[model samples]
Target: MTAEVPTTPPGDAAATREASERGGLPGAVDPPAGGGEAHAASDSALARVVREESGRIVAALTASLGNLDLAEESVAEAVEEALREWRVRGIPPRPGAWLTQAARHNALDRMRRDRRYREKLALLAGATVPTAGEVDERLPLIFGCCHPALSPDAQLALTLRAVCGLTTAQIARATLASATAVGQRIVRAKRKIGAAGIPIRIPEGDDRADRLDLVLTVVSVMYSEAHLVAGRDAAADRDLADDALWLSGVVAAALPREAEAHGLHALLLFHRAREGARAVDGELVLLGDQDRGRWDAALLSEAHRTLESAARLRRSGRWQLHAAIAACHADASSSAATDWLQVLTLYDMLLRYDRSPVVRLNRAVALAAVEGPVEALAEVDSLESALAGYHLWHAVRAHLLRLLGRDAEATAADLRALDLTDNQAERRLIVARLAR
Candidate 1:
């Protein structure tokens, strides 16, 4: 999620401000707040704090309140309160604890104010504030959001918004949906959870297997989005990818028998091991062009071991196929030495599991390497209707066209690819290719 938290809605502004003045932060503050400059600084600091600590704060609130919607609303109120109160009184020494406490207070207030939550009032009243150890409630929240009862769309939207703390727009962009659609999906999902009384706790046994698929999907989506970062705030992108990586590792540890979990961990590790070579001199580097020497050998080895372990569980999935493909690249001495036939075989298996246009496009590239441009061009052309708006599709078509000595068509395809993307690094690479 971006560091910038949207301002509180108008209805909650007064309540949040009131909550702030009533000792929201850790330190006691005298009334009569500071000037506008101090307010601005506090707002900036609050944004940073929220971005860094939002997951833990929201997790704790959800665990205590047992309502995803209430937890989110209360956390928003607490953050709004922090923006105002921290301006007058400097940020608390224990910011996470302060946010948790403030959120807890808001949750209690919500319970008392709303008749529907009267029953939960007793629960809220007895809820003890978590210390340093109990703050990480994200895993529980993840399981709750991805419950089997909810549709896949609901699972994805809720997990991204609630567990990952991503904004609607970020979720929309990552999932290729309109922001309004994503927001509506989240709202509906939360409503269903509340109406159905879905407990906000980790599932056990067979229930865990059902939910594990959804959890792996969420993590995989996050990891894939990292590749599209295109040098736009590389540090933030890396942090997000690392978060996905960490989450996958946690899943693998949690479910030792789930082969897909280990497979996902392996897949993410392979991708992460090559992150350094994805860009050079501020230009996006294609996988074939990336410097293999820059890849992390330790990570590569771990990926191999993890994939092997997953294979032994007698399970096969898209993640396992992807990891195998990555291993093929990692084991190659250079691009020229890459096992295109083996890579093509992996893509074929992946296509059976996932026939999305993007997968087809990638498989076409492998086909070009293994068969010939003529056959690959046929496959690419068939996907035009499905992937016309995807920049990478056009870019791949352009590469195939160039290989076939169709310079004019290749140039047109390259221009179309450039028009589809606003990412600066991507633009540079496409422009350089056009120049050639």
Candidate 2:
């Protein structure tokens, strides 16, 4: 794992596919080769490990180096070296361990050469990797990045960067923003944290709610982007989704008394339970058309139990309400058997918590089922100005428009949706409509 030493490369192992989903956030580069594509399987595996283990790595390094800036820079440098070195020598058997070792070495080398971190060399020399059972700093790091002093966009960039291990480019795509914008936000946020001495650990008592709300919101977006964003790397998406769920569980466990924590966990579980049936052979399946038999019974049961726990708290939050809406669908024997009235009612109640256009757009879907496509289409039309940039808005409009026999208008809407998204699966659904 030492970059400076000459050692035999590990034998070639099967490398997973690189992320292919493209169509940058507002304006984006081609999806990052994640791990660069230079070495194929070796590079891909390196990228995956880095993304999956970054939070753990950063936490340990930052704790040891006692400088967040040094930890991040060393990791980034190690990655760059790995991209070159890994290509020559096959990826190591234990990618995370190897990466960690390399990053530690990288940190040591930086301290020796870089004047700024020189004094911290003693700390780095004695630092050991945190054991598995030791306190995991990821949640604290997430809570810290999401401090109220930073703007929402800044909070997102930092969490995804520090806690989720996403490169700025990946985060940019997720937020539908330019990379420059995301990078700048991250830098400014970091400086603010340093200058203001904003604590990264979770706050105690009454002050906790504000940041925790932001944490849950960020986690939700992370999970949603895994499914909603178009990508060819199903494995990458799965990894990201798995991490999001893990993050949710960690938060819920840390704050057992918090209703929204349980609610968020339950909501994610409900979604995860249905993930298996969400698509077939990479083609998107509408909720009404998904194979119900493919849903994970165990996850569904767990979700229900978690939701019950949240309900027992007698605290009504948006997370619980969203979980309730998901439960309505999860409980149905078939799509047609779903109680549209109840679903609509939940959305109506949800409006009090979140009146965003996206929520209204979802409400319109229920309206389509209960009041017919005409009413739903009207509701969707009202959100055009607010949601024009979002692919799902155009997609739902196309669905409602098509249902009402407005084929020509539907086609236009469908095309618009297609343009706004690069996700292959979503595009396929839209293309199929055009082909029909």
Candidate 3:
């Protein structure tokens, strides 16, 4: 189950806030106070803290415990302890370090209680607790949890749990699955890793390349979720985007020769540059309506530089092509100025590498931009069977039909999209479109 914010009113936000404050699970934090400015700032700060420290904590714990499931359980327990103790004692000067130490103690205690765990305890007994500066040493554990032997779903679950420090429920909300479903997936994945005796160490050379795709996939998923709340939600969410970027940088730094890593980093940077222009006065702003002048010129320049590096590597990957397409849009000052034809070409190239419904839905948008709504409608139509439950597919079709003057059909499609989506903000936007 992906973690998600509950859909209740602000009054219930307090309960959520307490749950998060206690840290028994990932994403149990309280809702931000104040509806407008104060809430946004608080949320942003919280998100930043999570993104920065979660991976380090998870990495350190996993290394110490030598079992993903045990490590996670211990970490969650430590966080819960912190919530209770910190409330009266006050937060430690280094919260991450405190949590890490607490979790390590918890793990050690658990091992001491179980005779079967004695062997693992012996290995960990002499190991020094990790400091903030030593967090990078756990990179191997990050790769191990995201290994390719695991299914994509398993990889995502393990990464969120072991790498991103998210609770199963949070992951459930993020993936639009049930908490039970997500929990089971995490359990099964952990069991598989343990039973398979998958070594918790990074591979070298060709073996590393085999796992690269899985690693990239995890980073991309994190970035996508981060982008969803990039600017619209509290500042805390913005930290999620930053966290994803930081982790991608870690991957890139470790594998500088990997073209796709550079490409993914560039793509995220380009998309992030538009965060400031994505919303106005608490309302969502479509890309077409956003003010180009508000875009981050510095970030845009950095994206271009990364794109150049990816190209110079002489390897063509999905991320490289997608970043190239984003660059096309970024180069344009306005929607009308965009190179739709070039964007369409890039989408076609992306289609060859990725068959994701989301990718197909995006390609349909580019098709509409360059070839008119009718052609785009054709593309959307072809995806109908495959994307029956996807909100964006219907939303795009609704827009295309509206442009084609099919009001009734457009309204039906819009309603369908609205029914399929659970995100309150996204739902409101679709409802408004249908009302129009």
Any idea what lDDT model 2 has? 0.73
Question: Which residue pairs in candidate 1 collide?
Answer: none
CA lDDT of every candidate: 0.74, 0.73, 0.68
In model 1, where is the ten-residue run with the lowest total lDDT?
1-10
lDDT of 3 by residue, 359-427 (tens): 777877888877788887887899888767656667778888988999999889888877866555666
Question: After aligning candidate 3 to the native by TM-score, how far in Å is the CA of 95 from where it should be?
Answer: 1.7
Best by TM-score: 2
Runs in model 3 with CA error above 4 Å?
1-51, 129-138, 169-179, 229-236
Candidate 2, 81-132: lDDT as tens digits = 6666667677877778877788899889878887877887888788776533
Error of 3 at 104 (Å): 0.7
Tens-digit lDDT track for model 1 on 32-60? 55465666566556655554566666666
TM-score of 1: 0.85
Give the candidates in order of TM-score, highest first: 2, 1, 3
